[model samples]
Target: MSIVNIIEDLNPWDKKLHGLFQRQSTEKLTLIFTTRENLDKNSRLRNELFQRYSVPEYIWAKVCLRLQGYFGAEDIFSEDGSTVESHVTWFHFEIKYPFRLPKNKDRAVAEHQPPTPAQKDGKKPAGYAWYKMGVVTSWKAPDQHTIIFFDAEDSPAVGVRNELKCNCENVKVEPALRNPYWAHQFLLGPILACYDEAVWNLRDHVKALEQGRREGKHTVTNSLDSNDRDLNESSTTFNALHEILRHALHKTEILGVAIQTLNSICARKKIFEEERYSAETVAKEETVQNMVITKRCARKIAVYLDFQLSIVRSLEARARANEARIRSEITLAFSTVAQLDSRVQAEIGHAARADSYTMVKIAAVTMLFLPPSFIAAIFSTTFFEFTPPEGEKVSKDFWVFWAVSIPLTIIVFVGLYPGNRGLSVRKHISSAAHHKATTVGPTVASPAAPAANMV
Candidate 1:
């Protein structure tokens, strides 16, 4: 099927979606190996050589679906089938790569964007960013091996193309098996390279996190010593690292699946070669050479695949270890902050207790002099003069004053300083209440007793 037909059938709204983007045409990296010319050709065009092959319609549909950012029934697509005189396969997967971080003081920093004011002041820290590359590879029949790299720029793709150029003569020249699958190894090389780069980026990120954690430890120590409770920087760093590790782990899992896909391709290619060999009743010299080369290629690829798997495993293990380390650091930071908070709370409690003691002392002094001052002021008033006018006898009104003042003074003292005296007063009141209750109980029971007897 043609690429246009596949696109039209799979995504009917393709033309409408095109107007939304004001960008240039897609930058696709396509490598086409053709046996007709006995050479490989490079193209920037999308699906130029893919249309020349006898690829199954289903494969075309899968590629179309993947390009549209959707895989209908499965998240991963790996389909292989044989056509007359050729073997075909289609694969699609996403791989991650770290985005370029800005430089600071001749070193790459972990900040995804420019640091905000808080980050600049060391109140917050930033994390790295990663972007996903959607990659698709198609091995078409009748001498076409097409690899398509989408959403990637020229660097890695150019490197792959250059490597293929250097090695394509082996497959094309005489005495060298013209098995195109030999080129498959180089095709997959870039993916492994991408994974290697990603893992290294994560390693760098882990190192940065370790450094940050150590620094945070010192900062927290100082904060604890100085009684500074603000720990937003440490908390922010923890959260950022947590998020980065989560993404890194997920990408590692995808890498695992991708390695599996690579293994599957190698296995299926071997099986296809075997089937092709068995179906030939009379093996020509060329066929024998192709078979030998296919076998050797399979063995070499197996070793390579093993190496790839081990590398991925090692990288994954290291990533998980880094994650665990970051987690431990976060726990320690939290504990440190909690300890600081507890200390601050204890200090605050002591201060509050001291304030209460001071207040009590002031209250005691007030209670000591308050009654006499109040009494003197009252006596100095016109109504109760200590030195009366010569004609006026400081009369019986002074007795009245004494009678009112003495009792009032005693009541005021009892109310103001109700220490043990308050308890004694309460006990006396309780006794009176109990005595009244005892006396009333008999009278109340007398009525009930007579009524009960009548009953």
Candidate 2:
């Protein structure tokens, strides 16, 4: 069999070949490929290329006419012996209607009529077969140039690519169809999976923070030890941790979008492969399944990625506010706990940390003292009998009345105090602060140890 050289001679084709892989045919094939490997391996195509676009309805019609050769010329997306000159001629024709449907009346009809099963969707056609959107076609001419139809305004390839969630901007021909940094590298799983990891991280972090906030744990915003995980931290350490998270949120969002888009591309590849079949047979169920699965996976991944991006952006704002809130509370809590009014502050702090049961008990005890104190205040001076025992009745006065009233008040307060609940809450808060202090405590001398004498 003679070598097919339909696309080798053109400078345009050659330029497109760099960073791109082309499978040299026993014949020349000017059409773009699904992967770089396609250029080197010569075989029947069982897998269809991924659609990286979503074509509008009108251009789809022109592609149908071009495939049917309504231009009175070679099919623009054929595997036939297309020459470089034909490509040049097609380019001239296609550039005319960059965004419009073909001017030819017959082409308009062919595009309107469906020919593929994808258009039928398991239902019998209603007099007219619908068209599949992304099928690649070629137009060849006697000028020895084979025109690739993917870039043609009429070709379904570019338009259908929109179904794929990738960025196809300025997509010129290249020797390779992918970039090393962006390719399916093992360093990270597929792009979709990577996005999933970030989402998980954000979710878990938020959950933990909410729990800590409720419990008065003095939780660190985000942090890392030498082992690369968040651990206990001082106020300073947590401050640094929040700053780092704030910066990473940006990077995480960008990666999330990219991963989602790649997953979508992978998914679209499966459906496209099944759609490659002609009207003859639909037996390749596995191929159909693969495409459908990949498409679904891609769609899901894109959704999550978008969601993650949005969350991270908003989370950045929220976390900043939250971190500041925590920091301020911590500062105030520390000052209160350490001052001369420490027990009073501890009571407040205890209430802050107390369980519902504990808070209820403390509240009950505080309220219990109010009535006796109020009664004493009202009767201390008004009741002369009680006071006379202080004057002539016992030669006592207001001082004596106060003397008895004050002791009774003290006793009442002592009896009504919420002993356990207040203590439990105070312990919980101090324990959290203790953990924070210990994490950074190594740098400082112990409170129990005396300072070393200086020479």
TM-scores of all predicted structures: 0.59, 0.21
Best by the lDDT measure = 1
Candidate 1, residues 1-455, lDDT tens digits: the string is: 11110111112223322231233222121243222111112221223334443333353444454441222111112253223343445554454554333332334432212232235655544443333333344433323333433333333333444455454433432221233354456556655555665566656666666675567544543365532244565555667667766757766676666666666765665665565446452263237656677566556766765666577677667667766765665676678778878888899999999998789778877776666677768777897445656788775456755676667667776776646787688889899878867776565455545553332
What lDDT does the true structure give each of the candidates?
0.50, 0.36
Question: Deviation in angstroms for 226 in model 1?
Answer: 6.6
Model 1, TM vs. native? 0.59
lDDT of 1 at 391: 88
Q: What lDDT does candidate 2 reach at residue 51? A: 17
Q: Which candidate number has the best TM-score?
A: 1
